[model samples]
Target: MIASDARLAINPNDKVLPSFSHMADAIVRMATKPDRRSGDLLLWSDTFASLRRLFIGVGAGALVGLMVGLNTAIFPGLRAMSRSFLTFLSIIPPLTLLPILFIAFGVGETAKVMLIFIGTVFVISRDLHLYVLQLPKEQITKALTLGASDLAVTYRIVLPQIMPRLIETTRLTLGGAWLFLIAAEMISATEGLGYRIGLVRRYLAMDVIIPYVLWITLLGFLLDWLLRLAVARLYPWYRTGKE
Candidate 1:
């Protein structure tokens, strides 16, 4: 693959592709450099910062989504209002609202987090509402027959059913969250994996771009794997056990 890329790069009209040797040297140089802008340490720190933004956004969004979803499911009075609002949010392109987020929340971390939040929250909420509605009606009746309150029914019967599903939904939404995060970083972040990649792209730094892209891919894979393991281990009943 590198050889073919080298061949293509050798053509004057084609884009330059750094050889493996150049890439490796770039990695070594980057890893040892003390310059915070492009140093490997800086990259990792920025990556962690971005991860923090992602984690907080997804965590808060999922929790809010679940609460709002369940509330609308249990209380039909609020159903029309909440459902319509969430549906409105779900249909809008999140990227199109970037300027609004920046204007409302500013171009700082708040806007970035809000961007990610909007990207995944409504979708998760809608899916969670569907899952809640699909639950066996008999369970609610059974819990009520035992003298359980509405809140008790939701907590004991519905919440348990959706917890695992929520985790799974979050696993799927991680991709969207990453997209929003990178887009936010590319737009205004001073330090982040996305910012670094966009920065290097201006100079046609293939050696840096390739590794950064691979690193982002690896991080995403690991996050998905961890979520899968959590579902398998913590919610064994939810697992299909297909493997």
Candidate 2:
């Protein structure tokens, strides 16, 4: 019933654009009101699915990037071997891989998640590798002098020092992650913020599209703010720019 109402609200050949009130009303109805068929209130289920995708992409990408970066920085032999490959992967535009990814992973959740992961990992890894490399050699030397194992020093000494920087990098890459996510969902998805926008676009549902865009922006801002707060609260010793 809600979908039919929405369909009536938008006609494919209709040149009439919806007014701001109409758009706002549509957005409110879709978000707060219920559908006769689904019985589930609002689009919260879709929102949750999108949120899961976002957190998974960011968490996994950050973890892989940090591990690869640390390994590259700490192991000279591994660094020399993997440097060229890293550069190669970094230069290849992630979008160009969409076709290959869809082909390999299918038009499913895995493909979408992989898109976000691949989009972010290289930049994050490179930034972290450079950050680690920039650490003062004296610190490593001091740790060695204390009879600390290289593994112990890298984990206990180096990781803590760079956590703030890693958080900053994660914040920076979020935009690209969103871009990749939206593109993937637009190409192939049943439900996501991007999927909803794409689905509604067929009937020129500017109302839904606009609200979805604002929601995505709001979500990104909140995530970035949370990361900043975590840095301040969890790692009080690391001074951010405002400090």
Candidate number of the best lDDT:
1
lDDT scores for all predictions? 0.84, 0.83
lDDT by residue (tens digit), candidate 1, 1-243: 666476766773333676667677776666566665454465567678889999999998899888888878877787777877878888999999899999999889999999888888899998888788888899888889999998898887899889989999999999999999999999998888888888889988888888778888999999999999999899898866655
Poorly placed runs, candidate 1 (over 4 Å): 2-15, 36-40, 241-243
Off by over 4 Å in 2: 1-17, 240-243
Q: On residues 1-243, what C-alpha lDDT tens digit does candidate 2 reach at each position?
A: 355456557773332355566678877887888868776544575677788887798889899999898889888887898788788888888888999999999998888888888988888888888888999999999999989998998899889888888898999999988898888888898778888888889978777777778888998999999999998899887784566
Decoy 2 TM-score against native: 0.89
What are the candidates' C-alpha RMSDs?
2.5, 5.0
C-alpha lDDT (0 to 100) for residue 135 of candidate 1: 84
TM-score of each: 0.91, 0.89
